[model samples]
Target: MDLVLLAIVVGIGVGIVVGALGAGGGILAVPVLVFLLGMPVHSATASSLVIVLITALASLPHHARRKNVDWRNGLVFAGVSVVGAVVGSRLSALVPSQLLLTLFGVMLVAVAVAMLRRALRTRAEERAEAEQALAEDSAAHDPAAHDPAGQEDAEPVATHDDPVLDQPGPDMVDGADGIRHHHGEPEVPLSPAAPAAPRLPLVIGAATLTGFLTGFFGVGGGFIVVPMLVIALGLAMRRASGTSLLVMVVATAASLLARVGTEVQVDWVTTLIFAAGSAVGGMLGGPLSAKARPSTLTLAFSALLGGVAAVTLVQTLLG
Candidate 1:
């Protein structure tokens, strides 16, 4: 009963991280299970996958309702990633547990650094935009700034036959019959043009790499997937976070399926309880995430990843 309670508490924390950032559940879960729960590294990794799978699945509806999930691109990325997941799962078994954990720690540190840099860049961009807006607003209210030549004080010279008014405006063009026509106005409204397709090679490469990491380290791969969706697919941060969850569902499922007959022993009872707590946390996190600034979340999450990585590395080295 005590262990079960602890699992639930841990799950909720992990779930919140996963839901808010659209990743980090598995990254956090594996180490927690190994260090706190005293589970073997292999079992912890396998169990972490289950926890991430459930949390991602649970949080997906919230993002979907917000129209954040890019279904077409997500599906394509997931489909290609499945193949990589299968291959990675097969390779995971041959690697020793110590080396795997070491690699995980190193990967976490690298991801943390990358996220920190991105957060700083986003903050700078936001600050610049705010300054520009403020300047524009000030200029709009200042009459003198707009009329440095003092043209506003000059009297208006109106004429009955103003040549300027008779001339065609920027939107007007002379027709073949020498009649001026409004080129901007159409007889009928045209449908909006379709969005340009994402770069295929980049999508494929990113998906494959994410899938491999998911299967090998029992991660959801959302850390990588979210960035790929944003940079390669041109999705907004919120939408990319949501779409990453969709990709994680598929990747985690594939990785888990590949381990079906493996020797990895999972604590199903504990896993289920943890997943239940995570589901509830995910529900709360979705709305909270919508309210928070993306750069703030990124910076906070990166700090978390760095702390976890440092601890994991220290523990492994001591052992």
Candidate 2:
């Protein structure tokens, strides 16, 4: 029952939770370190950052080794996110812990529901695409599937523009700033449209903000960030997972810096134990996550969020 051994245990437990469930464990780390181990909030916060940082760093290499991460996309998102995280880290000093926890719970639940819906829609679309491909395959295999009408020459339609109505693009139609005026399309198409420029800066800004929340409120923010990437940014599941780990690393790093030179009583042993469990789980989690149906991942994520909220609430109430 040595002190460092105790810290390692806590660390490994937190790691296991993050790897298995992907969030909320980080938040628990601060409180446990402070209460059970008698570390002040400041010291506990810093130490928790160390734990999160190590866990994220360890987990990230696996994603890279598996070639699961899109480096360009992750780096772009991380760049913008650093600024937001710095701002958030500063703000963390001002916000009360109770309020932060409450907000975190609300956000977690909301994001979970949104992701679940998206997973369902993705599944339906995938199924439809599969059926279409099968039908096409059968048609191509059959001798009579092709019709004479399919060989008909189709004429291109002429473009018409209204000088008063449409905005210009490409051509100087009607002298409207040399822009083409293609008619009959939504002014700004929303999500589900064809992939446009990747919003690398915006994604990074979001991650930074999320990082600040992590430092301030002790939230990992992976739950929120992961869904946002999938739904808002249109990133795939593995991509979201990889990007989240990267952002987590930055947030933890900041927290560590924020707590340096403080007399923090870190239960190194506990932390180490938690990190060990998480390391193994992290490796297993990624491939399992990839094979999971989107809907299942979404649903499971929501359930975990709820479970974490319940645990926090109970602890808060009992305390």
Highest lDDT model number: 1
Name the 10 consecutive residues with the lowest summed lDDT in model 2: 162-171
lDDT of 1: 0.81
Error of 2 at 81 (Å): 2.5
Q: Clashing residue pairs in candidate 1, if any? A: none
Q: Give the best candidate by TM-score.
A: 1
Over 130-227, each residue of candidate 2 has an lDDT whose tens digit, in order, gives 67668878987877756767647633222322111122221122223322223232222222444454455656556666766676655566766665
lDDT (C-alpha) at residue 192 in model 1: 40
TM-score of model 1 vs. true structure: 0.84
